[model samples]
Target: MGNEANARQLDHHPMHGVLKMSEFINALQVGEHHQQQTIQAYTEYRFAYRICASQLRPVALLQITYVLEAISSATRPTIILQNRPDVASLFTIDPQTGVVRTVESNLEPGSTHELLVIASDQGLPQPLESTAFLSVTVEKSNELRPQFDIVWLTDNGTPQIYENLTIGYVLARISVRDAKYDSELSMSGCESICMKQTDSSNVYLLIVCGVFDRELKNSYNLLFLLSSDDKVILEHPVHLEILDVNDNPPRFEHSLIRVTFNRSADQFDVPRIVATDADHEGNARIRYSILDTNVFSIEPDTGILRLQKEFDCSAGEVRFRVVAEDGGKPPLMSIVDVIADVIESNAWPPVFTKPLYEVSVKEDAEPGTCLLKYLVSAGLHWINLYPFDPYLDN
Candidate 1:
């Protein structure tokens, strides 16, 4: 009102219609003075994010992307998905776009992952940070098959199983990885051989149903079938190589061996002894040894008994045993009785018909009378002589 009164007073005095005084008065208004205020747009915050876990598969170029969506806010607020140590390995988030993605393809089905999502507005000094909860459910998928570690396979691609194990021994610890929560193992005809499985783990222990003989069967081919609740996953083949154990002992060709040599003849070797073992390869290799080597020594490789030194007829008989040993974890042994005899020498002693002989003449008849005779003893001698004695004494 004061501005209007002043404008009217100035119009009557000077510059009335000369400088467009009506337009100037129209431009001025008399009222309470106020300061201009700026209005900021408001945005409502959201908290929960529910993602279906079943949608994710291992088929991804880099990573399987999941949308981490939020509501639009005033001043173009930026949304971010936060990471936690507990589920850090499972997933990652984009700060600006709010897109959630997986870090690996090994996510378990039917598992829940928790994360924190923050929504902030474009405030000057500090942005208004809002916290929200993010949850993801891993749905079941049949994309991946169970696998066995390369440690289970040998150079020949066969699994190893030790022999001479107790009734129940763990051959291997096989774990089957799957993408479904209801995956199960079908082990048919396993119990017949005493092969059993642990309740909590996929590991199976080899059972010694009966005596294990490498000579009989060295390995067994095992087929395991894996099936999900919906369908059969795969059939795994494992060849178990059963290692050998020293069990069989060596055996001889004869229980008692008789070896004889004539003392009159030159030195000669006894026949080669033959021994055998049920074991295979190195375990079957038998080494020969004699208990008494004084008069007789045996060749280990050939088992031939050679005369080490001379023996006289006085040594009538020499008896010993030859042992055969096989190469095994614990060597097997056997013995064969050896009887060695020496025949008498070729030379013979003299044998006389009488030591003393009494020869009587016919009452002093002829001067030369035939009386007793002396002879050279037994075996064919080079020279033979028989002499007659002329003794008359009784």
Candidate 2:
């Protein structure tokens, strides 16, 4: 095929499509190269006529098979793909052509395979070989699913998150596996929470996106999904409890209270003071106390007020402040003003100054005879009254 006689005969009598064939040969002689090639994981690739071919010639009419070989030698070059021993079994190349394919099914995405393609020609003295560097990047496949590990927020074996946390506060950490470079993570069922993935290591952070109130809602159910190419790959469900915070103070039913106390009685019982707190658990427990203990006392648990000390019947009024405090950690409190009107009543009966009235004429005194005088007192002053001997001890 390299003889001068055959070359002249082909030039005089050109075959059909010979001009296109000449252009292909010229392009091969010059050179063409692909900087890099990318393919999806577990997919096949073919190099075909892109092998080390320098020229081609049609030998005969009966056999139209073209003999393609390197211009440097008559024998065809052997193509070999070189990879690291660790990943050598993952890829293979045909010795005849440069067709490369993955033999292993489990090829990770975002992995770059650096391979050395050697084309060696069968020369007489020393074989000529040329090495071409090939970079093949495995792209992510939609069929692959994602895996993840989550660090849950919990208290006493119960999953919970503290309320009143600031926005962007991290609730949990998640480490992701088998995820692509373009994979996305999202959360549903909770508008107050969101997920964010880190730039490195594919780690995700679950954070607070809105406000949380334990009194309004105590628990939440959350769903998280991992997607790639707009397709869902994994789903996770989380059950969480919202921890309580002392945000509500005790509220009094009445800001100002009025009561009437009768000094004629030994003690006065006040009406129950009502107060409420809108917090949960221990934060809602309320205790009552009075600022002035000289005349007023209150129950620590029941908020029952009582007049414990004696006061002048002529005293117009008594004013005091009552405090209602909750049992929270830092404790919240509220106050109410109380006014008591003291009055003396005439409904009480007379009392004797001495238990035994032993006047001289008491035993033989008649029913109308005055045995004793000035025996009882009323209010803050003493009053004189006629008394009769009802009984005498022998």
Candidate 3:
């Protein structure tokens, strides 16, 4: 009605039974003047809208699309009844101009910000319109959870040195609750626990388990401790034990004995021969006996060697054998030669005899002639003797 010649087609919706062709044409020429005026008034009032995320971690701004829709109404021309900005378009806004612009940038987590909207049309030339400033906050989805289990084993209740015990005889049953979901569990320093031997009486086991978060990959360490009571008397890093075996045989330190006796000595003073065995007391039980009867007699249980008859040191040396045997499956026997030297206390003295003789031919020669004289020396004494003929005396 104001300028019918410049009127455009009422190609858009009408409002309040009034033909909006003239208003539309006017708005187009003046660069959306009606909408721009409305935006300016709204900016003076400064409307605020807030957008928040479930988590605080970093995320792509375009990934979250907050759709904004326009509503249709009457009595205001085909105007913007309601306006909203989408989260997907947040990064496309220019911070300096407070208007929607193209931005190929990443948004960091926990970054609080606001966005401004502007008109986007080929023919319209108007100042940017900030429909509403949106405050956005980013957050992560969820927290990390840790999980794991324990296992253990041992062979014998009591162990000794050189004894082999089977460890891992009992296996440890371990399980992690949330391991498969949010965390991971690993075991280390456990190989020793599985195959370790107790080198000392006091032996302990230390097993370590580690838990890591799947998201952060952070590790947490834990230990399971154990102790031994029966086999182990003290606490040590290794296991110890003892084994019984028949590796040593009984033996006497001396195999033979030689003794001296006096002929006049009383039988009550008979000499005793003693022998020892290296084996344990019960295993070392030994019996002694005289191998020959003529020389001496032995008290089997007491191991006493007594002379049957008197011994003289001056006469000669007596030799006798004694035997010692052990009580075993295959009895081991040992023989000792007992030599008794006997000597008389008083010795007899040596005597000498001289022979008397006469030679017949020597008397016819000369009264002064002498037969060959001979001298004899016996032991500590010496004697001289002469021979004469009996036929010369007639």
Candidate 1 lDDT by residue in tens digits, 1-394:
2111001110001111111111111111112321112222222121111222222311111111111122222234355666667777666654533445566666665566656655555533344454445555544434343553323433344355556666554444556554355666554433324555667565554445655567777655455555676575544444355676778889876799887665444445346678878766788889999896588788999887777787776857889889999988678899888887766555566666667767665786654454545565665543355444445322
lDDT of each: 0.51, 0.59, 0.36
> What's model 1's overall lDDT?
0.51
Candidate number with greatest lDDT: 2
Displacement of residue 92 (Cα, Å) in model 2 is 54
- On lDDT, the stronger of 1 and 2 is 2
RMSD of 3: 45.5
TM-score to native of every candidate shown: 0.42, 0.46, 0.28
Best by TM-score: 2
Error of 3 at 187 (Å): 21
The clash numbers for all candidates, in the given order, read 3, 0, 34
Worst 10 residues of 3 by lDDT: 5-14
Give the lowest summed-lDDT range of ten residues in model 1: 5-14
What is residue 167's positional error in candidate 3, in angstroms?
18
